[model samples]
Target: MQNVTVKNRNWDIAAHMYFPEPFDQSKKYSAIVCVHPGSSVKEQTAGLYAEKLAQTGFITLAFDASFQGESGGVPRYLEDPATRVEDIRCAVDYLTTVTFVDENRIGVLGICAGGGYAANAALTERRIKVVGTVVATNAGRAFGELNPLQTLEAVSKQRTAEARGADAMITSWTPDSAEEAERAGLAEFDMLEAIDYYRTPRGSYPTSCNKLRFTSMSALITFDAFHYAERLLTQPLMVIVGDKVGAFGSYRDGFDLYNKAASSNKRIHVVHGASHYDLYDQPEATGQALEKLIPFYKENL
Candidate 1:
């Protein structure tokens, strides 16, 4: 695993490059930029995907977003939707300069919240020739007025407070520990599935750039992803969503949105009997999911 720092539009980005162990420098391989989820790091499931994709004869990169994990920023864990989208483009921009990558054959994979960023980035960033998202999210509906629990008045107040330089203390949805689990606030959200991957040794890494900020709530509440989704029809989009998600109802809603995009080619695949997290790392499920993605990008990109 080799780590390198790259520059994004407004931030200094941290990216991990995984190439075949032989590490050939002269070959210009197709590249896939993997985007991480909200409150997560590159070493999580998205990093796993980047490594796996790299093993499949493509150069892959997984990076932490600005203000999170290993990436640079002042107000940490801030969820700026537009900035998040630019982060994906930033990865693409950085990849183009790598001699190992064939600039025109670049692809992107977004996991969980990263999926939404990848999709929105492809809307206008034509350099992203191929795109796929796993357990994708619709940032528009997940935040701002799209979140059912938040009202426009609430967003207005939050926006006003943020503009006034209010010290943002964003509340985190994930439990801090077993003790925190007992004090967990939301019922449907207190699942052990997330705990196993996030807090446990099964996936957690020390270098991961994850810092839960108190201001994330207000920042996220004002972010929406599907605002310009209809304009993405000129390119190709492939969306993969799981069959079961009791908490995330709109997990696949972004797929429906992309299908409506002005895109020339679009596809949506539902993994049978799979939960949202299952699509993240379950071997059998991910194998099936990538079988679909491999063909899609091969034919499109």
Candidate 2:
């Protein structure tokens, strides 16, 4: 894997580019952009999928979003959905300039909320030949529990406070540890799994900050990543979801995408016994996902 930086507007997105074993720069190759879940960095699950896909003879890129991880942005840890969608497009822009990449054969794969961003971007970015999602979380809907008007009001106040020299409000996406989660009565299956994967050595990385800027929540609550998907998302699409759906609701979002997409060539795969977080890094679960993804990209891209 080669570390690289992709330019998204003014920000430099930190990324890892994975080359197929025995790679030949003289030959053109299909490329896949692997997008990480929300609150994650390129060093985590996105990087894992990129490496695995590269081993299968495809050039894959895993990138940190513009405002999070190791990427460049002001108000670090912000999670603007619109900018997240644009980040995917910027990754594609970088891929198009590579000497060995077959620009026509580029595809995208996104995990969790990143999946939602991929779908949203593909609606307008026709250069993405195909799209695949794993445990796709529609972030707008994920934040639906919060009333948008109320959240916006709170964000306005927070922004005003910051302008007046008040410190920014940083919020954690999960508890600091499993014990902490349990103590706080956050025992949901997906929540526990997330804590295990992100809050511990099993998957934690220094750059993977699990916190978000409070002002970012305003955009998240109002944004709908899958809006107009039925009409505009016409690319060849694959939606993969775990059978054991949890609070994150990626399972329902996956099915919703499959059912609503106008694409004539679309498929949905359900990984048996896998939960939302299992596909993050579990060998058996990720193996099952790639079994479907390998051929899908091979044939579609």
Candidate 3:
């Protein structure tokens, strides 16, 4: 594995590239682009999946989204869905330039919000031969449902404030601790685990700060990850979600994608007893997901 940088529109995306053992540049190989969840960095779950996929004989890349992690962008922690979708395409742009990479065989895997971005990107980025999503969350629907009118009003106020030179606001996915989550009436099983995974030693990393620009709420609330899937998303698709991810309606998003996709080749894999956060780093759950992913990419890409 090696750390690298790819130049996007106006940012430098930091990424980790994993090469298969005994890699030979003369022989072209299929490549997979792994996208991380919102407010998360590549070094966390994205890198884990990339490394695992590389062991299965595919060159894989996990990249930090623009304005987040090690990537270059203004107003750090901005979680713009459109830019996130384009980031996947930008990664493909880099992959196509590598002599050892087979341009015709490219796949994309997205986790959490990244899954939505991957699906959106595949709608038009025809270079993506296959699309896999792990515990995918439709950002627009998920966040919008959390009091849409109120949140939109709040975002409008924040935008006005920022325009008046006020400091940008920041929001977090997890509370500082599980106790805080419980006290705040957000102590759902998946919610608590999400906090533990990203905030505790279980999966915490310096760059995975779990922060997002408050101004991003507008895009987060309006961007549909699976927009136009019924017409444009014809690539082979696989949506994986844990049965225990009911707390956040993760399975609903996966099912919606499966039901709406126009792809003739599509499958939904449910990992029993695994919650949304468990799929992030749990070995047993992640292993089950990889079992499906390995074969899907092998046959498609």
Give the best candidate by lDDT. 2
lDDT of 1 at 228: 68
C-alpha RMSD of each candidate structure in angstroms? 3.0, 1.1, 0.9
Tell me the whole-model lDDT of each prediction, alpha carbons only.
0.75, 0.92, 0.92
Q: TM-score: which candidate is best?
A: 3
Ranking by lDDT: 2, 3, 1
| Candidate 1 C-alpha lDDT tens digits along 190-263 | 24556666777876777543355544555566555555677654568888887776565445565565666676
lDDT of 3 by residue, 1-301 (tens): 9998888887799999999998897999999999998878998998899999999899999999999889998879888888898899999999999999999999999999889899999999999999999999999998888888898899999999989999889988778798999889988887888888889999899998878788788888998888899999999999999998556777999999999999999999999989898899999999999999999999999
Clashing pairs in 3: none
- What TM-score does each of the candidates earn? 0.86, 0.97, 0.98
* TM-score between model 2 and native: 0.97
As for lDDT, the candidate ahead, 2 or 3, is 2
Model 2 gets an lDDT of 0.92
Q: Which model is ahead, 1 or 3, in terms of TM-score?
A: 3
Clashes of each: 10, 0, 0
